[model samples]
Target: MKAVVFSRYGGPEVLEVRDVPEPKLGPESVLVDVRTVSVNPVDWQIAAGHLDSRFDVRFPVIPGWDVAGVVAEIGPTVTEFAVGDEVIGYVREDSIGRGTYAERVAAPLRTVARKPMNLGWEQAAAMPIAGLTAYQSLVRTLRVGPGDTVLIQAAAGGVGSFAVQIAVAMGARVIGSASDRNHDYLRQIGAEPVAYGPGLNECVRALTPQGVTAILDMYGGQTLTSSLDLLSDESKGRVVSLTNDGILEQGGTFVFARPSKADLDQLTRMAESGVLTPEISTVMDVTDAAEAFRLSQTGHVRGKIVLRVMGRLSAAIH
Candidate 1:
C-alpha cells in the first residue's frame, strides 16, 4: 500500500509517499479501503514534531486521524460492520505511527460510524474529528439548550463552523466571530456574525441584553477572556476552550473532545437530516499530503481540508 510517511519530523517537506506494508486486522478493528481523509491542525503539528513529548513516536510516521471509506475487511470479533459498509472514523490509535494518510487504515470498531446517506466520501471524511469536537464541546461539555444564546469563537474555521451549526440546531441563538469576509458565511449557517476583536463583547451584548448563556472557544487567550465578559452570568453560563488551557484558570472548561463511536453516530444522524453540513475548503489527491499540510499550516482555511485517496474526481461541496 502507498502511504505518506516522515522518517524525521521537520516540516511538510519531510512527508513523502512510499510503499508500506499493509496493516494486519486486529480482533476489534476493521480494515477500511480509504476513500478520503481530512487534514486537522494536529496533523501538521505532529508532522512538525511539536507533539513528540506527548505521544510515543516511531520513525516513518503517517500523520492523520479523520478517515471516510468502505470496509474491505472486518475483524473476526467485529459484528457492527461487514465487507462493504460505508463508514467514517476518527482513527486515533494509542500512540503514533500508522494513520489515515494512506490507502487504508485498521480502524477500531469503537471509532467507526455509518456514513450519513446525504454526505459524499469527502464530506464524510471531513466530519469525524472536526464535527465530533464541536458536538462534544457544545452538547457534552457546555450542555447548550433551547432559548439559550451561545457565542462561538473562530466560528468560520473547521470546528467552529460545525459548532455554530450544532448550537443552532439545538435551538440556541448563535453568535460567531470571524473577519468580515466570513461574516456572511456565518450568517448562512445560523450564527449572528460578530467581528472578532476588541469590540466582540459589546457586539454580542448589543444582540442580547442578558448576554450569552454559553461560550464555545476554539481560539483561546484574548479571544476567550474577552468572551467571558459576554456571559449572562459567571455562575450560570458555561465555557469550554479547544485551544488554551489557561481557560481553566479563568473558571472555564478545557475539553479535548475524545473520539467516541456514539458521538460520531449522533453527528451522522444530524447530517442525514440536513441539520449539520460540513464545509470543505480544499480538496487534493492523497499524494498531495504535503501541499495539503502546507495549506493547513496557514490557519486561514474556512473549513476542512480533505484528501481524496480514491475516486478523486468528485467535486467538493462549497
Candidate 2:
C-alpha cells in the first residue's frame, strides 16, 4: 500500500509518499479501503514531535487519524460492520504510527461509525475528530442548552465550526470568535460572530452583558486565559479547553477527544438530518500530504482540510 510517512520529527518537509506494507488488522478491527483523510492540527503536531510527551512515537510514522472509506475486510470478531460497509473513523491508537494516511487502515470498531449518507467522502472524513471533539466538549462537558449563551473560540475552524452548529442545535445561543474574514461564516453556522483578539472579552460582553453561560476554547494561552472572566458566575466552571491543560487548574475542563462509535453515530444523525454539515476549505491528493500539512500549520484555514486518496481499492469479498 502507498502511504505518507515521516521518518523523523520536523516539519511538513519531512513527510514523503512511499510504498509501505499493509496494516495488520486486529481481531476487533476492520480494514478500510480509504477514500479520504482529513488533516488535523494534532496530525502535524505529532509529526513535529509536539506530542512527544503524550504518545509513544515509532519511526516512519504515518500521520493521520480521520478516515472515510469502505470496509474491504472485517475482523473475525467484528459483527457490527461487514465487507462493503461505508464508514468513517477517528483511527487513533495508543502509539503513534499505523495511521490512516494510506490506501488502507485497520480501524477498531470502537472508533468507527457508518458514514452519513448525506456527506461525500471528503466531508465525511472531515467530521470524526473535529465533530467528536466539539460534541463531547459542548454536550458532554459543558451541558449547553436552551437559555445558555455559549462562546466558542476559533469558531470558523474545524472543531469550532462543529461546536457552533451543535450548540445551536441544542438550543444554546452561540457567540463565536474568529477573524473578520470568518465572521460571516460564523453567522452562517448559527453563531453570533465576534472578532477575536485584544478586546475579545469586551466584544463578547457587549453581546451579553451578564457573560456567556459556557466557553469552548480551541486556542490556548492568551485566548483561553483571557476568556476566563467572560463566563457568568453560575457558569464559571463551564469552560472547556482543547489546547490548554492549565485549564484544569483554572476550574475549567481540558478535553482530549476520545473515539466513541456512539458519539460518531449521533454526529452522523445530525449530518443526515441537515443539522450538521462539515465545511471543507481545501482538498489535496494524498501524494501531496506535505503541502496539506503546511497549510494546516498556518492556523488560518476557515474549516477542515482533506486529502483524497487516489486509486482507492474496490471493496473486496471476504
Candidate 3:
C-alpha cells in the first residue's frame, strides 16, 4: 500500500510518499480502503516531535487520524460493519506508527462510524477529530444549552467551525472570535462574530451585556487568558480549552478529544439532518501531503484540509 511517512521529526518537508506494507488488522477492527484523509494540527505536531513525550512513536511513522472510506475487510470479531460499508473514523491507536494516511487503515470499532450519506468523502473525513472535539467540549463538558450565550475562540478554524454549529444546534447563542475576514463566515454558521486580539472581551461583552454563559477556547496562552473574564459569574467554571491544561488551575476544563462511536454517530446524524456541515479549506492529493501539512501549519486555514487517496474510479464505484 502507498502512504505518506516521515522517518524523523521535523517539518512538512520531512514527509514523503512511499510504498509501505499493509496494516495488520486487529480482532476488533476493520480494514478501510481509504478514500480521503484530513489533516489535523496534531498530525503535523507529532511529525515535528512536539508530542514525543506524550505518544509512543516508531520510525517511519504514518501521520494521520481522520479517515473516510469503504470497509474492504472486517476483523473476525467485528460485526458492526462489513466489507463495503461506508465509514469515517478517527483512527488514533495507542501508538503512533501506523495511521490513516494510507490507502487503507485498520480502524478499531470504537473509533469508526458509518459515514453521513449527505456528506462527501472530503467532508466526512474532515468531521471525526474536529467534530468530535467540539461535540465533546460543548455537549459533554460545558453542557451548553438554550438561553446560554457561548463564546468560541478561533471560531472560523476547523474545531471552532464545528463548535459554533454544534452550540447553535443545542440552542446556545454563539459568539465566535475570528478576524474581520471570517466574521461573515461565522455569522452564516449561526454565530455572532467578534474580531479577535485586543479588546476581545469587550467585543464579546458588547454583544451580551452580562457576559457569555460558556466559552470554548481552541487557542491557549493569551487567547484563553483574555477570555476568562468574559464569562458570567455563574458560568465562570464553564470555560473549556483544547490547547491549554493550565485551564484546570483557573477552575476551567481542558479537553482532549476522545474517540467514541456514539459521539461520531451523533455528529453523523447532525450532518444527515443538515444541522452540521464541514468547511473544507483545501483538498490535495495524498502525494502532496507535504504541501498539505505546510498549509495546516500556517494556522490561517478557515477549515479542514483533506487529502484524496483513492482515484476517480474508486470514488464513482462507491
Q: Which ranges of candidate 1 are over 4 A from the true structure?
A: 234-237, 311-318
TM-score of 1: 0.95
Of 1 and 2, the candidate ranking higher by TM-score: 2
- Pairs with backbone N, CA or C atoms under 3 Å apart (clashes), candidate 2: none
lDDT of 1: 0.88
- lDDT at 88, model 3: 97
**Model 3 alpha-carbon miss at residue 55, Å:** 0.7
Give the CA lDDT, 0 to 100, for residue 230 in model 3.
87
Give the alpha carbon lDDT tens digit for every residue of 1-318 in model 1. 778889998888998877788998999999999999999999989988888888999878988999999999999999999899999999998799998988889999889999999999889999999999999999998888898889898899999999999999998989998989999999999999989887888888888878888888877767777778778765343888888878887788888767799999999999999999999999989778889988988878899999988743222111
lDDT of 2 at 278: 98
For candidate 2, the per-residue lDDT at 115 reads: 99
